[model samples]
Target: MTSFALHLLRHGAPVLPGRLMGHTDGEPTAEGIAACAAQAADLGAAHLVSSDLLRARAAAEAIGTPILDPRWRELDFGAWDGLAPDRVDPDALAGFWADPDANPPPGGERWSELVARVSAALGALAPAPTLAVTHGGAIRAALHLLCGFEQHQLWALDLPYGVLVSLRVWPGARPTAQIMGLYP
Candidate 1:
């Protein structure tokens, strides 16, 4: 079986810095775009894709023309969208943190749902070196889908803005991948 590199790059910092930005469509700061572009500049990926949101798309455009895919969008926080952590109920937030599937944000997507969505997106990728400029949440979802990490385990990773995760994937009906590298 042949393996290809799949790079998941988190979008740069959004104009709205500290908030639950899922589906909020915040714009990226100029420096943030520059940082993301610089990080991806030398990656010679054969294909590039990005989330349809402004933050991700703008950062991706700084690097190159990217295929826009909504499936790469951040996890939907629904009612909690754009609110700061301090603004939300601590108990509710804790519930979400403890088990996202059972205690998703008021109207948000479940962890399993995010995994499923990312799984579909991953399944559709061609077996070639690819890079996707997307959200931290979406990147985590992809990690879960491809690497089989549980939601809690995924939380341990510190994927800040402009982070990159490279994976070696063997594409198939049930694809599998291994971590090749992680770049901050």
Candidate 2:
């Protein structure tokens, strides 16, 4: 079995306020950029990857490594993209929570769609230690695949700003992850 390490890093805080930020290009805050630099210093991997979004890409760039920007961006919240979750229709939100895989956001990509794209991205990476800086939703999707957490359980995973979660991928098997919150 090919043993490869996959480090999943969530992006830092964005400059936008009360915005969903899905598919939206938003830069990270000054603190966010500093946090990324600090986190990058502790990372030992040579390979790096990032979402196309500016927030994630900035973080990846701060790592001082070549990045593979993939089209598998965060889940498209569509009309809800810039709105707070609480501001969205309650029924719509509930429907999404109850059956996320089936019920996509209004004009947004479904969980299943995101999963497929992310899985493909995972397959495209070199079978070596790699770092992927992305959004919380992407991290949650990876956790679902790695740890068998149901969609509803995704909420339980607290992905802090600039946090790093390490996972080992064995070919033809599920990945295993160890989440280290904001490692220095």
Candidate 3:
């Protein structure tokens, strides 16, 4: 069986946190940019992929490799996009977390939908060592696929800015992950 290695990276520090970032474009902080460069230096990927978001794209570019921009973005928080975590309704947040797979954000995409899109994108990528720069939600989704984690558990995973998580993928099986945190 032919195996491929995939490096998943979370984009560096973002500007806003209130609303759902989903497809909203945001740039990385100066420190975040440095972190991205450092992570790229650490991974040294041959092929790079990233979310179209400016933050993610910048990170991909810093890697100094060919990058593919994919449309599989983070879950749309809809009307909840820009609200702070504390400002959001506790019961609603709990409900969303309780059944993430089935529940869609007030105007956002469902967890299952995001998973499917990411899975398809992963399938379309060339089978080789590659780096994917994306958002925390995206990384969490990929982790769900790679680790068979429950939706609630997705938040449990620690994915810091510009971190590189290595995974080996095979046909019809869960990916094997080697998580490595890098310096900014």
Candidate 4:
């Protein structure tokens, strides 16, 4: 059984900060680029993967020529893609939070869908040490899908800009992952 190491790196700060930012491409801030590049330099993964979005792609590009994969994109928030938290319908947002899978945002991707997409990507990259430069939501989905953590339990895990979360994966038809560490 060969174990592989997977590092999930959150993209740096976006130009439009404090917004949902899903599927809405935005430039990375200067500090975000610098921080992600610096952190990426420290990671020595054989392969680099990233979301196709601008912020993640820019950071991944700073590290190396990453394999841009749209599967790594942030959760599609649809109508609420670029809106601030306060702007969305409060009841709808509450329903989304209460049960995201069963109650998606007006036109957003279901939580289960995000988990499934990220899980498939993780399963495909099972053999080598890979660095996935992605978003906080994707990382959260991985945690939920791979580690069996409940959605509510994920709130305790702080995923900040340029955060790195390493996992040891035993890849198979039903893959399993053990958390290695978190680098903020």
TM-score winner: 1
**Tens-place lDDT digits, model 3, residues 137-182:** 8878877887677778878766777776777766454444444433
TM-score of predicted model 4? 0.96
Runs in model 4 lying further than 4 Å from the true structure? none
- How does each model score on lDDT? 0.91, 0.77, 0.72, 0.89
Q: How many clashes (backbone N, Cα, C below 3 Å) per candidate?
A: 0, 0, 7, 0
RMSD of each: 0.8, 2.2, 2.5, 1.1
lDDT-better candidate, 1 vs 3:
1
The per-residue C-alpha lDDT of model 3 at residue 23 equals 70
lDDT of 1 by residue, 85-140 (tens): 99999999999999999999998998888788788788878888999999989999
Query: Model 3: what TM-score?
Result: 0.86
Clashing pairs in 1: none
What is the lDDT, from 0 to 100, of the residue 77 in candidate 2?
88
> On a 0 to 100 scale, what is the lDDT of residue 88 in model 2?
90
TM-score of each: 0.97, 0.88, 0.86, 0.96
Give lDDT tens digits, candidate 4, residues 60-98.
998999999999999999899999999999998888888
Residue 82 in candidate 3 has what lDDT? Answer: 61
Candidate 1 — which residues are off by over 4 angstroms? none
Q: Select the stronger candidate by TM-score from 2 and 3.
A: 2
Clashing pairs in 3: 18-82, 18-83, 19-81, 19-82, 19-83, 20-81, 20-82
